[model samples]
Target: MSDMANNDLEKYAKALDNAIMKYHGLKMEEVNDTMRHLWNKTYQGTDIDGIKIRSDVEGGASKRSYNYRVVMTKDQVEMDMRGRCSAGQKMLASIIIRLALSDSFGQNCGILALDEPTNALDVENIDALAESLVDIINERKNHSNFQLIIITHDENFLRKLGQAEVMEYYWRVSRDSRQKSVIERQRFR
Candidate 1:
């Protein structure tokens, strides 16, 4: 990786850590330490299963080439996410990544969306996710005009949101017996 690319990745990682710390009350370094534990595998190969990877060139006047993948020593580990993560973990990871990476691109991404966040989650995990979501929204509420759009069919998840003071809008979407969709929007404190 070139200096610029590495810098960008580090910036994103830092932003992710900071967001987790602010919203979840986690220390960035400690969260990084936890993620270190999560990465259990490492490799020093030019390609993944014989597929070639792009290389970066560097030198003063004459350029030299090196493979970005040809180095590994406990720096990071790959997350076999689909295989290892539970449904709720995957859901939460997706939301957290989306929120964190968005800031890496845009300064103030006003809107963050999640589709069917309660999908595949048990009742307990669903409530835990709702609590985390509440914390995230509360943390961002005072910063600027931010929005959290959660599209879920679970009535229990809605209930976990409690009254609506923390919510700017409560969108209740449903469908008739004919399968026609309807959307209703209401304001909340």
Candidate 2:
């Protein structure tokens, strides 16, 4: 399966945003600003906060290649540097989803399934990610609708989240070729 399907981007991003806001006690506007800043710095000119995004790709038979240009806020952000630029776009998509969720259904939503949220993030970004997740849980505490199942191999990262009160359950999974993955749940005290 894809790292993240396009359809699910909005949902995931919203969850992420809510998590961040809840943990930090930040306003929705602050979350948006932070997300936009991260996206701009990482993509180096890409404007994900803008209203629309447009892309174009070019290639040939002898040599396969592409030229991607994203137009947002009436500004043209072009990437002709080297490799596939889709990765950056995907990251941006993830951020966008988080922002959208926090802006809309943050109060009503209860559960979130996050698969390797820090896969492409740097050290700083990872720290930010942790803070964001914690914030979401805290913000939704009164509603008690927030539950998170985060799948990752990063022990340290998991530890950070485990510190939160809302993280009530933990599960470990082991897989063998002959059998399906087995899940063991550990209740947090």
C-alpha lDDT of residue 53 in model 2: 26
Q: How many clashes in each candidate?
A: 0, 12
Candidate 2 lands at a TM-score of: 0.50
Instruction: Please provide, for model 2 over 107-175, each residue's C-alpha lDDT reduced to its tens digit, 9 standing for 90 to 100.
Output: 576667778876766565566567676776676667766666678887777777777656787898988
Candidate 2 Cα misplacement greater than 4 A, ranges: 1-89, 92-96, 102-107, 164-166, 176-180, 187-189
The stretch of ten residues in a row with the least summed lDDT in candidate 1 is 43-52
Per-model TM-score on C-alpha atoms: 0.52, 0.50
Structure candidate 1, residue pairs in collision: none
Question: Once model 2 is optimally superposed onto the true structure by TM-score, how far is the C-alpha of residue 1 displaced, in angstroms?
Answer: 59
**What digit string (tens of lDDT, one per residue) describes model 1 on residues 29-100?**
333333222222211122221111123435532233443321112224442343554555555545544544
The lDDT values for all models are: 0.54, 0.57
